[model samples]
Target: MAQRADISVTWERWQATPDGQTARLFHLTNRRGTRLTVSDWGATLTSFKLAMPNDNLRQLVLGCDTLEDYLQSPYLGATVGRYANRIRGAKFSVDGQQYKLIANEGENCLHGGEIGFAHQLWDAEIIESIPAVRFTLHSPDGDEGFPGNAIVTVTYTLSEDNNIRIDYEATVDKACPFNLTNHSYFNLDGVAGDVGNHVAQINANQYLPVDSESLPDGSPVSVEQTAFDFRTAKAFNQDWRKIVSDQRYRGFDHCFILDQNDGSQPVAQVRSGDEQVVLSLYTTSPAVQLYTGQYLEGTRGHNELVYQNRDGFCLETQYMPDQPNSDCAEECIVRPERPFKHSTTFAFHC
Candidate 1:
């Protein structure tokens, strides 16, 4: 069995960090009996348990059992920001001024910096009216070498219809790169099996190709005849090994430009092999990055399960990777005058 959930919508102190701050957890339940657990540590969605048709509950996302496990985990269920994906060569020019960022992934930066918003402690509030946890963080100017004081807010709300909605809003004092997204690895079959048989359909006709280093090639390419095509529903592992067999490539790390997106319609849909559950992803963002967790190597997870490669998959809805360097059509810059607002929802159903 997976970790039991607290049915009561209560906020409790989960752990006391050595740094003197407290990590809190807020448990939320919807009218349909779906439960969601969020942590204040990174504004992370720790657990998303859906009530199965068989009258049982199943944990749908990959998460850690403890705060310690989350500290060691690689961006699992965390709200990553300042910037979400790669920044290209650890540098980008904003308003004719070139800024150098911390390089955490080889010579390139990945998910903010060496110490990103992912590991930061956020101020949490449980809104009684909506049954949501609102997390706010203030990033001072020059934090992680970024050139602006950014005030960011992320809210996790569990709707009565079993949709896990994430609302992100941010404002920066100066023009800077601001792409925020949740990095939650989802496996509809719980954490017991791989996601090979998971059926996925993405509403995208083109995808952003990448270079050898996994940086965007500054343009978009058609997904036709390529394994990157998920425009139609198909088994996830179908032709997966043949696509990523070279070992130099991680599976499905490319970004798919959402088709006919106006932020209201779902951009992608995924289902378990047994057809027991279906997850619909709706986002305001123009693109969704599909990563198959090709490098998921860890010893600990829910139920003490050792997570292996391809055990989970991430549907990170965001602008695009290396936004500043790429020629993506969407605007990735957020400034004081023009704030950034984006929302993503994962609607789960059986």
Candidate 2:
């Protein structure tokens, strides 16, 4: 552990990857005593402990105990890419050329297919000035059936103001759909249980409805007077029964269109069930996917806790799902002329 002023960074050898590469865990602490643990393997966030008023550290995100545990986890606090979300039919066209990707989901390419960025080991570098850790990866052309030789970087910075800023940047030699996000499940109460009682609000007037397979069914629909409406602060489970009633959908797993992309103001906010902590999310992404972890039943997590459905929730900030097959495909494609860059910040308050 090394300290400079009020910020500090510590690390330890975590575990070895399947290829015999050793992975390490980097811990960054801010002035307020907030701690964030990340690993070179998958560039994943293993834990986030927020300094509480009672002098007890509260873990806000769902994590695993070891690298093997994360291998079985569902994108838990991991950086997901070549493209986040799904690409319909496991195929798309780029420059009049049809490209068929590796299908991981049923007839769909999910989170960049079976071996996505989430499962790869990244090169980690500690930035002492900002008290940050930057993880970088190189994806060769045709890797995962994508047409691009790309260099991607994800930096996690713990600022003095209790903010975890995630900056993502990528450069591709060939044009390809590029979307990235951190899949961190947050439980503001810092416990393993449903987030039904958490008060939440989103700055989105419209959302994309999904089909039986959880893919976009049609165009964006108005959220007015619907269970998807979160324009005002309300309990996450206020309309819980309405969702569970429909077997096709278990809970909130749809993507909401953001009203702004400036990142100057918070696009969403959620207060803990106990009303002790609040998290404000600011992003430059065009959409935020709210997943209630409906499929997390029987999964084991940190501290040997067996997680049930809705044990945590994820707000994945990125472009809309299935964008590569939609009319807006061009808008998400990354070319040499237009490199990809975006940022999302999670600010904590107690």
- Each model's lDDT comes to 0.85, 0.91
Q: How many Å off is the CA of 9 in candidate 2? A: 1.1
lDDT of 2 by residue, 73-169 (tens): 9999999999999989989999899999999998999998899999999999998777799999999999899997999999999888789999999
Clashing pairs in 2: none
Candidate 1's TM-score reads 0.94
In the range 154-220, model 1's lDDT, one tens digit per residue, is 9988877788889999998899888899999999998656787999999999999888788887688
TM per prediction? 0.94, 0.97
Candidate 2 structure, TM-score to reference:
0.97
Predicted structure with the largest lDDT when compared to the true one: 2
- Backbone clashes under 3 angstroms, per model: 0, 0
- The regions of model 1 sitting more than 4 angstroms off are 1-8, 247-250, 328-330
Error of 1 at 231 (Å): 1.4
